[model samples]
Target: MKRILVSFAVLTSLAGVALADTHGAIAYSPSTSAIGWSYAHANRGDAETVARRNCDSSANDCRIAIWFRNGCGAVAVGHRGGWGSGWGYDGREAQRQAIRSCRKQTGSCRVIRWQCSENE
Candidate 1:
C-alpha cells in the first residue's frame, strides 16, 4: 500500500508539470531562421505576454510589437522607409536587420525580434 501511494503521488506531480504551458509558440519564415525565437525570449522572461503580442501581430505588417509583464521591446516597422510603408520586411535580411537594430536600444530592449539564426 505504501509503494502504491508513493507512485500515485509522483505520477500526479509529473502530470501537473506536463500539462503546464512550458513554452511559447514560435513562427519564422519557412526558408529563414528557426521559428521558435519567441520561445527563447519567454524562457528568459515572461512568456504569456510575449506570445500574445507576437501571435496577434504576426498577421499584421505594421508594428511588430513585443510586450512583457515587466516592460516591452519593440521595433517600429512599416513606418518611415519601413517595408511597404509598414507592410514590413519579407526577406530574411530585412527581419535580421530589424532585429539587429532593435537590440541596440538600452534596457530590456535586447529582445529585438527575439531571433536566433542557426546558420549564423
Candidate 2:
C-alpha cells in the first residue's frame, strides 16, 4: 500500500512537471514520505534555457513542483538556473527557502505561477 501510494504520487509529480508552463514562480512543502519539484520554462524555451534563466534570475526564489507521498509535500524549489543543469537542493526547508535557494543558484530559472495540489 505504501509503495503504491508513493508510486502514484511520483507519477503525478512527473506528469505535473511534464505539463508545467514556465512563468517564473516558486513553491514547496515538507513531506515525511514523498516529495515533488518542478520549474516552468515560459519564455526561456527548453529545459537547458530554463535552467540558465532560473540561475540568472535575481529573485532569490522560484516555485518548483507539487508533491505527495505519505501525507503531502512540495518539490525543492531550486534557484531558477538550477533546473535542467542538474543543480538543486533537497526538500528540507519551507517553500520560501526552496525558492530562495533555487533563485539564488542561477537566477533565470522560472517556475509555474501557482502551486498545484496533489490529486490523490
TM-score of each: 0.29, 0.22
12-102, model 2: which lDDT tens digit per residue? 9999977654432223221221222324334323423333344324434432333222122222323332532112222332334435545
**Model 1 — which ten-residue stretch has the worst lDDT?**
80-89
TM-score, cand. 2:
0.22
- Candidate 2, which ten residues in sequence have the lowest lDDT sum? 27-36
- TM-score of candidate 1 to 2 decimals: 0.29
lDDT of 1 by residue, 36-68 (tens): 224433253445345445443444332223322
Candidate of highest TM-score = 1
Q: Give the number of the best model, judged by lDDT.
A: 2
